[model samples]
Target: MGMEDRCLPGGKHKASPSPEGHLGTCHLYRENSCCSPDVIQDLTKANDIYWNRCGNLSSRCEDYLQQVECFYRCSPIAAQWPHPKRPTAVLAVPFCQNFCDEWYDACKEDLTCARNWLTDWHWGPEGNNCNRECISYGQMYKDGKELCETIWDDSFAVSTDPCECLTLSASDTGFSASRSRHEDSDSIEEPETPKKDSRRSGRKGLCPGSPLLHRLKKNLRKRSVFMEDVEGSGSGF
Candidate 1:
């Protein structure tokens, strides 16, 4: 997977943003994003990640996980740090101290068996299965920094300077697109309001629901092909 603009290969992302917000779980990337509505539906069904194998997580912990999922699955900025060989993966993604701390605090009580979720798990044709002893998150990583920096290998680089970091939130659009995360910046601008187009609102009746998802899937099947971005495939985040 050679470097590409705003989208890594082997994922259900747009070659470029489709100029409209998607519905359901991935709506955070609504403003000039990559993933589509069908991708959101696909994500909702992905229940085999090792993080959940220990048991259910606290709601607060789950929200943070959702935010991380939003970034890995939907955010266009993810493309900036593409993995060396995996077109569907990213490395050294810019993240903020506040988020890491908050996420660690939220999930510190949650149980996890592996230090690295990707490799520590036992993998097979079915899905990833736990391979190690289950223990509290507090016991696995020293702190938030270690959790973020170590969990996915070199996948995320945490920033101390708050303004120069990525939030993985709706406000992320305010973050300058052209600036490299490694560069110094003193401030983060406010997100600009997107002008409403009656033509775009409601997706012209393509609202979020199973009905819309089914319709989209049906039409795509009729085409007998997948979009190039959707062709990107990998094992995990």
Candidate 2:
């Protein structure tokens, strides 16, 4: 989208520099600021802080630059957005002593705001400032809002999925069909194996009854045989 079209309302954008205690967006001037000293100073200082903190990191500078840009972009919205919320803490300094941890935290905050704007200002059906097709829109968010043909066919429906959680749209019958096909494929690929009982795998025990009862039965049988033998021999006493 064009830069001018992407401009946020003045009330919604404002950033407060922490250490320097400065308050402003990257657009330090009301007019074009290509050669403005204030604009240049802010950019230089912000870059210095970021580079010092991230110099040792092995990644490209693209992500960092985008994050730094957020202060310029979103700070304006944070400042004058219709909502009466307090000014957002936009870090002017790039590098932190905390290093990686702090960078990750800062990036998340900026990106989150960017993502919201991507939907509300650009991708949402009602969006006038931005369009869903912008590369930056995809970079800032997962999936763009779903643009679906309404059942009536006279109008279209659109909704932004925060966090880009799901790719499927409610209007998509194809998604359901694809899901069913996948499930069928999975079933055909592998059938359930029958389970065996482990308890019956071993040999049977000698005593069907309790150990004590079996021992008693054997002793009684032996004693009766001995008595019968004694009675037959005339030693019944």
* All candidates: TM-score: 0.68, 0.20
Question: Candidate 1's residue-wise lDDT over 1-237, tens digit each?
Answer: 312235755656677553445456566566556777766564422434645778877887776677677677666667767889676778877677776887799889998777886678788875777788888888999898999988777788887754446656544543333433433223323334234211111122222333323333343343233333344555343
TM value for model 1? 0.68
Q: Once superposed on the true structure, which residue ranges of model 1 sit more than 4 Å away at CA?
A: 1-5, 42-50, 175-188, 192-237
**How much is 4 displaced in model 1, in angstroms?**
10
* Candidate 1 lDDT: 0.61
Q: Tens digit of lDDT per residue, candidate 2, span 1-237? A: 222213333333322221123324332222222122333344323322322221222233333333334334332222212223312222122122222233333333232212233123433343233323333222443321211111111111232222211111121101111233223211221111112211111112222343222333343354456656886898547
